[model samples]
Target chain A: MALRLTGYDEVMAQDLIQSTWITAVRRLESFEWKSTLKTWLIGILINVNREQIHKEQKKKETEQVREDTMISKSGTVSGYDIEQGLIQLPIGYRRVIILHDIEGYQHKEIGAILGIEEGTSKSQLFQARKALRNWLTDNSNEE
Target chain B: MKSKMNHEELTPEERAAFDELSNFKLPPASLEARVINELKNQGLIEKQKTMNIYLKWTASVAASVLIFFAGSYWGKQSIENSDIDPNLAYMLILHEDESFRPGDPMAMFEEYGNWMQDIIDRGIKITGHELDNEAVMVKASSETHFGEEATERTSGYFIVEAESREEALEIARKNPHVKYGGTIELKPYVVR
Candidate 1:
């Protein structure tokens, strides 16, 4: 059985689900039966999320220059132990890690969702795991 | 410690680590209720969009009706401000070729006359003719030919039934003679 979402994971998942509902409603007429309705709806939500993140990044660049300039790669911030680190990773890596680890989706399924090859999805997952493991190691050293 | 034993199988190692890491109990049960309520609020947005579209359509229909009556009122006012004579009609001379045709000056006039006949048939009385460019020269009448005051050159003429000079000029501009640097001089004719 899949684990229940909690903390920032639950919050972020909720945010994504809400945004997905709106996209589904907006594009309901174009829904062909080529793929499952959930997958089609989730695809639109992914694109929407990408656009929102891009706009947010642009806004952050202008208003909060410091926060946007250099990403905190060390990933040991006080509030963000692991949950925030998962969310804070760049979108490409986040998609890989979230699908494989948190969402319990197969690499092939992640590839289908992200429009990437299965091998590429596996590679991305490996990289994301390495980055997270490094962040976790660094976090434990501070303790 | 179990991670070492499970190192050969990356999946079990990662799963065990994730399970151990998320051991902390989740916060209050009210958070799920709050999220579900937020979802309901999001659904109401579509209803608001439909209402907006209906409001816009209502405004458009109202404006169209208002414009219909407003146009009729404007038309009546314009007609009241102007008068048209019965006998006087418009003349248009069109030269289609680079150089005017020899004796075909009456051809374009015939076309104009045919067009105006339809307007006349509709009870809006108007006649139109084409005048030859060479024939439009200031001509002396039989009596004036022998007079000392006979003029050799005069602008072309178009007779249109109008209450005033402005209205006459407005109608005269549509005449073919008004094109190609030709001037249209209007004169009121009394039909015996």
Candidate 2:
């Protein structure tokens, strides 16, 4: 997921994941088990990915909105399919959709992960779904 | 991590799409192993990265305690020695000395290719395309502009990653150009 989120830059994702592991290893004692460990780890991954996206955006702006991520490394999300459509979503919307829809994270969890309001996360997911539907229609017309 | 965690049902099309995406492939086995191995090798929590925020407070206190000793100065140098800076990108600027030629043409080029292959294997090189010797230059200025200026000539260039000008020089010197009459110029590749 970290690789997918980072436009399929595996090395970058691996670096981020390694940092996440270091963080997790250090804070293992503090974990109260309120959420499943997987959920916690996913949260860490999401934060790392978000930081990377922020850095890339700061460096390259819109130029970093990589179509190759979906077009190239996307597996089942191949071609002009809905998965392609999802990956094409703006980073914010894409994150929201992936977390809430695909990864079963609630808006509240997403808000924490993304450092956004829960309401913002909810609305982003709504907008993301709408965009995906629109993209599907546009792609079909192009076909 | 287990990825299938659907709770809210979406519209049929949305549901299908999301389900399809849930089967997203994991990163390669080697990447996973590298991460795990690095974490273990670093001793993750047991090493420099302390898990406790409270320890950070103590670290600040410890930092103050070191100011009285000369060891505080050594600490900065220690960090510089510890890790390679991965941020900066370096460029090997190929200065095409138009008249320069090695005695053995094939041997020089083969040596150049071998050096480049080593750099490529290290993954430092981004990409490069060497231009043909055929030259053309365009000039524009406040005065009358001239076409096909003679002074401008560059053979080719390669971009690589290095922390400092010295390091860039170290990488650039390996270019077979240095041994022959051709010149290798090192420059920091600035991302605009």
Candidate 3:
């Protein structure tokens, strides 16, 4: 449960939440009344995600090097319950959890965006949830 | 009989987990208002009408600049070549005189058409064909009738391409229509 507090917290949350606003503005024309406008905005965020991935790939290709792993120092903060251990899971599994659980995308929509079969999206989601639950259990035992 | 409780529903532990998960607040209200205002100002909503005017002016200025610079650049590149021969690649627009005759107008036109086909087939290189404003009005029959007489002095055009003006004239000499007594005018393309 990521909670709010101070300047550092605000800056970290900026990374997670900033793109939603820009996407809502850029894709105002494409908004249909099918789902909530927020969902449509999320659809645009998926496009932004694809663009970011493309830019990252281009950067990697140009540099011919892999980026370093990221770590946060405030691991034991009260709301930092995700068990920093879960961050070590493969990036694909992490992505599935973030897109599904945190971002609230459905399996079908996730499948469409990621260009995977719906069944594969479901399986990945299940595996990711199971892995996260296990990580939480293991960390709680340590605590 | 007493029934044993299964973990199908949230036990105390499950309830705590749910509460923890749902505790995170929605994004700040001020952030939402700021974002919506920014979106409105960005022309993503009601687009800026002034943009069309700005674009038109920009395009006109750009076109003018491009024309001036491109002409100067092209002139610089071609100056040496032009000195070697004043004409290289240029198009000529010619008006046909009203009174001129070939033996049979229709047959002569057919023969001229055949000549054009032969030139294409042989890959005798040329560029662009433009009918003069006056010549377009001159009937096909009139052109054929005029071709024999005026061809000795004038033609609808002398469209030629060569490394130099001299080469172009030499090429013109081989033209079936340019008779010994006929004239072919050479005009240089003056950059505007």
Candidate 4:
């Protein structure tokens, strides 16, 4: 889950996982046990990933813009695989799709985990699927 | 490829892709060791010391015998001196509420085990049991009710021998329950 959420950046995913475990241990006292332990850990991972993204955004703002333009112009992601296509998605779309589809979390659960409304989760899933489909189809045509 | 797929529905190809992604992948072998080491460094978990099998067995037997004799001697002394034992015993009532976050079950067990082991190593007589959710209340009028507030709230209890109330309070203060957002009620046993 951490790897998928971090666009398969192994180093970043490992860092996120390590941070998540430490945070979960330190903050275990605040856990109400209302949800399963797995959900709580995932919640912590998502938060850690969000923080990482925020920090990276400041450093890579110009680089991100250039990459976005290249992607738009090429009509396909740098790689043709579905996982690669997932990396090309906006963070919001990627998260929703990964959690809802790949992780098999319900919209309500996804909303609670992501701290978003159920409607928002549903809408993002729709948009994410559309985007992923378009990317995959365009890449297949290129092949 | 479906040209018009609803938000609620996944196309066959999408489902297959999702299935492929969902297939569990084992993380790096070193990650587990790294996590455990980090946890130990943070003092979140105890560093398990490796001991020789025969030596550990011998030590375990010696400790068991010592604890048994000590407990028996204390038990007899407490009974003979007075109805209320001279050695103060405090009941640590664990109350669980919304804030109590008992993280991983295995980790929680290990934590509690380490805590009780520490108390035992200090030569303090301690005993405890986790309470079950099932509880019933019987009124004086013979009316019985299930799930009383006290029974529902009280998750567990521990009785420990202490030299003084202050010492008992210190023990309670160190309990993982208190650290994990659970309330601990310390009460001295009274003789009727």
The whole-model lDDT of each prediction reads 0.42, 0.53, 0.40, 0.62
Task: Residues A23-101, candidate 1: write the lDDT tens digits.
Answer: 5544544544345333454455566556655664521211221233222234233323445445445567766665566
Candidate 3, residues A1-143, lDDT tens digits: the string is: 11111112453344324454455434433443344333443445444544654554521112211123222232221224442423534445555555555445677877765667888888876665565454544444332
Which runs in model 1 stand beyond 4 Å of their true positions?
A1-16, A58-84, B1-13, B20-192
lDDT of 2 by residue, B1-192 (tens): 112323233556556655555555444546534654675587642343343332332122112122111111111111112222335776676764556554343243236546654664565534343444345445564343323333335656656666567767877887766665668777675565
Between prediction 3 and prediction 4, which has the larger lDDT? 4
* TM-score of every candidate's chain A: 0.66, 0.71, 0.52, 0.82
Q: Model 2 segments beyond 4 Å from truth?
A: A56-80, A141-143, B1-9, B45-192
**Model with the higher TM-score, candidate 2 or 4:** 4
* Runs off by more than 4 Å, candidate 4: A58-80, B1-7, B46-192
True contacts kept of 4: 0.23
Rank all candidate structures by their lDDT, best first, as comma-separated numbers.
Answer: 4, 2, 1, 3
DockQ of candidate 4 is 0.12
Q: Which ranges of candidate 3 are over 4 A from the true structure?
A: A1-9, A49-80, A83-91, A98-106, A113-115, A141-143, B1-19, B46-192
For candidate 1, lDDT tens digit of each residue in B1-192? 322432212455456544443333333335434433564476422354443433322122221121112111111111112234645443322333333222222233233333333333444433232222232325465332222122222322223455554555555565443443345555555567
Q: Is the docking of candidate 3 incorrect, acceptable, medium or high quality?
A: incorrect
**Candidate number with the higher TM-score (2 or 3):** 2
lDDT of 1 at B34: 49
Residue-level lDDT tens digits of model 4 in B20-104: 6544444574665576578668765442232121122212222222222212111111111222253577889988777776544
Clashing pairs in 2: A26-B51
